[model samples]
Target: MKPVDDDVLLTEVQFKELFRDQSAIERYMSGPHPLVLGHRVIRDNRFLVKISPDNLTAFKKEYPHDPIVDLLTTPYWFRVHVYYDIVTSEDFVVLTHGKPGISDLPVVRIHSESLFNRFPLRTVGNRTSSRSR
Candidate 1:
């Protein structure tokens, strides 16, 4: 897969649509394998995002000991699995090893949608919403 450029910022609508379907999230979390190799995050102007290995290296050279790099360089194999536990009223996010039968890591559950896809669609549809069905 082509690397996502750091310049991209996901919009609110795009984020919501991706996570709009609770079932889809459940499927992603409980299906046979749902480990995500990479993820996208929003950063301010001071923060530089790099996807290419070479770019990342260059960035590290310029900003030695940058915490953002540490966050960006997290291992892709570390899986953050999302599941809806019937016992709980809301969804949960869990981090686990990509391999099966591995122990799970601490999880941080956030109630938000992916902004990239949701935002652009909104912008595009704003003009056409009334004209189209």
Candidate 2:
């Protein structure tokens, strides 16, 4: 493998074409946003969304939390899922609030994506997952 010295840059048009998704790009380009944890959303928006079966399996593998406890305690009504993206290292959750249209046209909360801030130096107990950062 050769170590290249020059920076590999792409034009705006090239960048946009390569990455088809625009919402994420627009979200960051638009403005600042808040950072919320999956546990907090589950705790706060308990009635809003329910854990999808597929997500439950994945979540159980990643995080050390009992969703059943949250359900038993708070009691969610609708079916939704908390998704974790390993590539971006972000949690993409949908809180429908038991509404019909929300699941289809979700209200997205956007935030600045920062790898440095995402993986902070903290105790293992406080960390979200055992996966390498």
Candidate 3:
């Protein structure tokens, strides 16, 4: 597997601090929107989901009897990470709610970190951080 980026990792303290903002909490509570990430499936075996009209049409053509297609096309809530460069007070207010009609893509916030990005520390223990892990 490819190495995780250090900048993407967040310390436990930083994670807690970020989550403490009321707006951030509100945003998380409001979300779970259907957004796609690069992660593997943990539950359902369904690998790909057809969302757009073209993809949906093709999916139906391939599997006419599959019921999952209907579910995929419908809106659903999905939780996603929202990365930020500098953790500011305003971020809490901006990211607080789910935008209607917005595509359910989860947001992964890539922030600055030393261990992940610094080339000198290449070992997994030295470089791996929790947020990206």
**Best-fitting candidate, scored by lDDT:** 1
lDDT for 127 in candidate 1 is: 40
**How well does each candidate superpose onto the true structure, as a TM-score?**
0.22, 0.23, 0.21
Query: Which whole-number lDDT from 0 to 100 does residue 59 have in model 2?
Result: 46
Best candidate (score: TM-score) = 2
Scored by Cα lDDT, where does model 2 land? 0.37
Candidate 1 per-residue lDDT over residues 29-119, each given as its tens digit: 3433332223344421111223335445555777677443343444334455666645634455565432332332222234554222333
Report the lDDT tens digits of candidate 3 across residue range 1-133.
1113211222233334534555643542343431211222212221222123444466577767654334343343434444444644122212321342343343333454343444667575756545456
Cα displacement (Å) at residue 102, model 3: 29
Residue 11's lDDT within candidate 3 is 28
Give Cα distance to truth, residue 79, candidate 1, Å: 8.7
Which pairs clash (backbone N, Cα, C closer than 3 Å) in model 1?
Answer: 10-115, 10-116, 11-115, 13-118, 14-117, 14-118, 14-119, 15-114, 15-115
Residues 18-129 of candidate 2: C-alpha lDDT, one tens digit per residue: 3346563343233232111121122222222222344434445655363331322343244566677889666665554344343243334454443333666667555545
C-alpha root-mean-square deviation, candidate 2: 22.4
Question: What is the model-wide C-alpha lDDT for candidate 1?
Answer: 0.39
Candidate 1 matches the true fold with a TM-score of 0.22
